[model samples]
Target: MLFGIILAYVSVGSVLIPLVLASFNWQNRSFEIRGLSILLLTSLICDASSMLLSRYHINTMPIVNFYLFAQFVILYLLFMRKLEIKNFLRVLLVLFCILCLIDISVFQGPYVLDTFSHIVGNLILMALSLYYFYTLLKELPTTYIHRLPFVWISFAALAYYSGNFFLFLLNNYLLKEAGSIAWMLHNGLNITKNVFFAIALWQAYHNRKLST
Candidate 1:
C-alpha cells in the first residue's frame, strides 16, 4: 500500500504536468488533450480516494468501480472520435454500461471490487487500442508515426492493459493471499500507464503548437 501511494503520487505528476501546460494554453485545447486532461484528473481523485479509504480500513471498491467505468467511457470517447466510429461505439458503450450495471448490482456489489468488469473492459480497451494502431498505420505515413499522439496512447493502453489483464483477473484472490505483491504490481503498472499518458499529452501539445 505504501508503494502504491508513492507510485500514485508519481503518476499524478505525469497527469498534472500536462494538465498545467494545457491550462495555460486554453485556446489550443484539442479534443484529445481535453479528454486526456479529464481522464488524468479523474484518475488522480480516484487514486487519492482509494488510498484514503484503504487507510481508514473502509471499503475502497466503490472508488475502484467508479474509476473503471468512467475511464472506459472517457477512453471510448477519445478513440471513438478519433476513429470516427462514434455511432457503433456509442451503442456498444451503452450496452456495456448496462451490462456492467447489471453485473455490479447482481454479481458484484459496490462494496467489493469487480474483477469481471475489469477483465472484460480491459480486453475491449486493448482491442480498441490495437484497432487505433491499425488505423494509424494505414492512414499515416511512416515519417509521421512517431510524432502522432495516438501512437503513444495506443501503445501505452495496449502495454498497460495486456500486462495487467491477468493481474486484475486475480486481484481479489491475490489481495487476500498476497496483498503486498498485489499492490506493488498494480501500482507499478499504473505508473507506466500514467507515464505513457504524459508522453502522449506532450506529443499532443507539440502537435497543437505546430498547427498554430
Candidate 2:
C-alpha cells in the first residue's frame, strides 16, 4: 500500500515540484534552464497520464515509449547546447527512435518493461552527462562550481540514470525476488533527482536576478 502510493502519485508529484519551481521567470531563464523545465514538464504529463491510464486498464506502454524518445531529445539537446556538440546528435536521435520502435513492437511484451530501449537511453545520456562533467572539471567554468545550474542538473541526471542502470537491468529478476523494493528505490531516487532539479532552478533564478 505504501509502495503503491510512492510509485504512483508520489512519483508524479516529484516531477511537479521542480516543474513548478522552474515556471517562475520562465521567459527570463536561459536555454539550458528552459530545456530542463521542458523535460520536467514532459515527465509530469507522462507520469501522471501513465498512472491515470493504468488505473483505467490502459496499456501505457505507448506513453512510456513516447517518453523515452522525448526524454532523449530534451536531454540530448540540453547537453548539446552546453557541450557545443555538432549535428551528429540529430542522427543519433533518429536512429534511437527506430531502435525504440523495433524494441517496442517486436521485442517487448505488452506489460513488460522496455528494458532494451531504456538501457540504450541510459547509456547515451550517462555518457553525455559524464562528458559535461569532464568539461566542467577541466575548464572550471565558474568560480563557484557548486552553484552552477547545469552542474546540478547534470548531477541530477547522472545520479538518477546511473543508479537506475542496474535496477533497470535487474528489474525482471528483482520483481520475482525482491518484490517492490527495487522500484521503491527507483521512486526514491527519482524524488531526489527532482529535489536537485528544484535546487538547480533556484540557482538559475537567483543567478539571473544577481546578473540584472
Candidate 3:
C-alpha cells in the first residue's frame, strides 16, 4: 500500500508537471524556456522508465545507469558549464557512470559495491542540485524571486536527496519497516520535485509571454 502511494506520487507528478508547463501561455512561445520544458519532460520519461523497472521486479541496473547518465548530461548542458563549483561534480558523474558500466560488465557478484557507487552518485547529484539552486536564486530577477521555480524544486531536491542519503547509510542498521518508511519519503521527495519543476516551467512560460 505504501509502495503504491510512492509510485502514484512519483508517476503522477512526473506526467502532470510537463503537461502543465507546456500548456501554459508563457512556455509555449519562448524557445529557451521551451527547451528547458522539454528537458524536464525527458527527465520525467526516464524517471518513469526506472519506476516501471522497479514495479516489475526487474533488474534496475540498466535503468538506473541510464538515468544517472542522462542526469549528468543534462546538468552539464544546462547548469554545470557556467559554474566553477560544478567542475568536481562533472568529473565525479563521469567517473560514476564509467564505474556503473564497468560494474555491470565486469563484476558478476557482490552487490555491495553497487550500493556504494549509488550512494556516491546520489551524493554528487545532491551537491550539484544545491549548487544549481543556489545559483538560480542568486541570479534570478528580484521581481521574480517569489515566482521562481527553484523555490519548490530546491526543497524537493533537498528532501529527496537527504532521504536517499539517510536510507543508504542506515540500510544495514534499520529494520525492514524502517527501510520501507525511508523509501516512502524518497518517493514523496520525487513527487515534490516533479511538481515543482512543472510549476517553474509554467511560471517561466508565463513570464516570457508577459515580456513579449
Candidate 3 shows a clash count of 2
Which prediction has the highest lDDT against the true structure? 2
Off by over 4 Å in 2: 109-111, 172-175
lDDT of 1 by residue, 1-212 (tens): 66666765675455566567556546655787778778878987887787688889998888988997898888888888888677888898888888888889999778877777778888989999998888776876558676777677777788878877867646655455765566667667777777777677777777777877
Worst 10 residues of 2 by lDDT: 170-179
State each model's CA lDDT, in order. Answer: 0.77, 0.81, 0.61
TM-scores of all candidate predictions against the true structure: 0.86, 0.89, 0.69
Please write out the lDDT profile of model 2 over residues 122-171, one tens digit for every residue.
Answer: 99889989999998889988899978888888888898888788787666
Better of 1 and 2 by TM-score: 2
* Cα lDDT of model 3 by residue, 87-160, tens digit: 77567657877776776567632322355556666676577667867777688656756465445444555565
Ten residues in a row with the worst lDDT in model 3?
Answer: 108-117
For model 2, name the residue pairs that clash. none
Q: Is candidate 1 or candidate 2 better by lDDT?
A: 2
Model 3, runs deviating above 4 Å: 2-14, 23-40, 43-61, 85-90, 107-113, 133-143, 150-153, 176-179
Report model 1's TM-score to 2 decimal places.
0.86
Off by over 4 Å in 1: 1-5, 8-14, 169-176
